[model samples]
Target: MKNLNPMEVELKLALAPAGPAALTQHPHLASYPARKQSLTNTYFDTPQGDLAKARIALRLRQVDGQVLQTVKTAGQGGGGLSQRQEWEWQVPDHELDLVALADLLPFQGQLSSVLHALAPQLSTDFTRRSWQLTDGLVNPGAIGQRSHIELVLDEGEIISGGYRTPIREAELELKDGDPEALWALALTLSEQVPLRPSDSSKASRGNALSNQHWPLPEAHSPAEWLHRATLALDAYHDSQQASFLSDAQQALATLADHPALDADARVYAQALPGGLDAHGQPSTAYGNAALALAHRLAYQTELR
Candidate 1:
């Protein structure tokens, strides 16, 4: 297998239960054969939640009878888009290899204390169907663009002790070129299937399940409302109920004049109501707009 880049950039979308079927049958993807894999991912952390507190994740993934250990750090960006540092290597078995992990991580000194306490906390079992797109193949309109992306649909369950939650989401990883291609493909896909940008990763969701609570963010201002809207979009996907969708719609409605929203983003935001609709479906318009606003907010906030 080929090694991935140490810096991982991806856009995650929360898919409806029926999304895989719709996505696969879509005209653009219907002809291409999907590469499928059964993946079992086990997440590890210390009994005292030290790794969680440090915003680090350790995982052992079993696929094709091979075991790969990976370590990830929380980097930046939100609203279903993120960039993070990751290190992965083949390991002997389903065991924690602190020595190997230490070789890959930058903070070796910090590992001495927490290494012994590390143990498996949760696992996600899923089937991944994926396709690769290059240049303007995914976007004929933007011919000669230098962009390579891998689009995947994952379906399965997150297992934590006695608790379990379904996993139905799409991920677009930027293998090469501009990250904007991710949004472009997502926008195209969302036109046919409802999609909500996911702020929660499987690791975060597992921790939430282990703790039995998902704390909601208070939306007091434009930036906060933008965050809340993204959360509501994800929650609605999980529940498929009207209340959560309503909250998302309401939150998005208040962000037109948000200082962080640029002209293009504002236009998308304005178009959101028509896409968000009352059917509890979040469109690609909503996804890209949320991401754009979030990026702008981060950029402006950093300058202050």
Candidate 2:
């Protein structure tokens, strides 16, 4: 994509599913919500004066459950100090329904006026567009620590994929809503994506493998098990090769209890170190001992 001036590019907006419509229109804000409509401004700075790479956004909602507007700034690369602003207003719930939020006319005049006022600092010929897609999913886990995933599909391209957290067990992202699109992408990328081993199917088994709580298993939930197995494999790798003593010990503990090891436990157990060195660090002897333990664990299931 050619870089446009951030100031000149038009804002893109979409209303995502926030929650049940009933939850958004809770009675608490009814009386005062009408008075809250206005252009709320936020600002940021960079020594290079480039606002295009910096992100800016706005959300508008009525006292009732109606969302009036949603806006996002474009990040076209430009060299120099620049500023991007977003303007939004709440739509009255009594006057419009949820679908009205996606209508282009409601804010067309306002958007024009704002764009005109900033025209000297921005480029003209910009226009607004909208598209719809199914809502994304939140990772099923604890409160205050939820993970989210979003997928975008255009034409025949698979635009994006990745984990929401640094240490999540498994994450799957499908860009297009079409089942065939997803299937084709999966087939094309099969070798690039890691496939889980079949034997470790129980969710409860993960608890015995690592310190982290693993999600319960349900039909078609191999991702979680694969995640646990990966972590167990990581710990085993660390125990055998990491330089830090604490890391090695922790890895050893994880490996010793991992449910995946069938015949390897005995060999691993025989490799663990006898004691710490004079410097209060694990000695080479300890590393050897840990290795022995790991080998035994890898080879013998009864040791677990």
Give the candidate number with the greatest lDDT. 1
Identify the candidate with maximal TM-score. 1
Clash pairs detected, candidate 1 = none
Clashes of 2: 40
List the global CA lDDT of all models.
0.76, 0.27
TM-score of each: 0.84, 0.17
Candidate 1 lDDT, 232-281, residue by residue in tens: 76655544556777778788787775665667667766766666655665
| Minimal lDDT window, size 10, model 2 | 154-163
Candidate 2 residue-wise lDDT, 75-105, digit = tens: 3211100123333445553232224324334
Candidate 1 wrong stretches, greater than 4 Å: 1-4, 109-111, 217-224, 235-250, 257-264, 271-280, 283-304
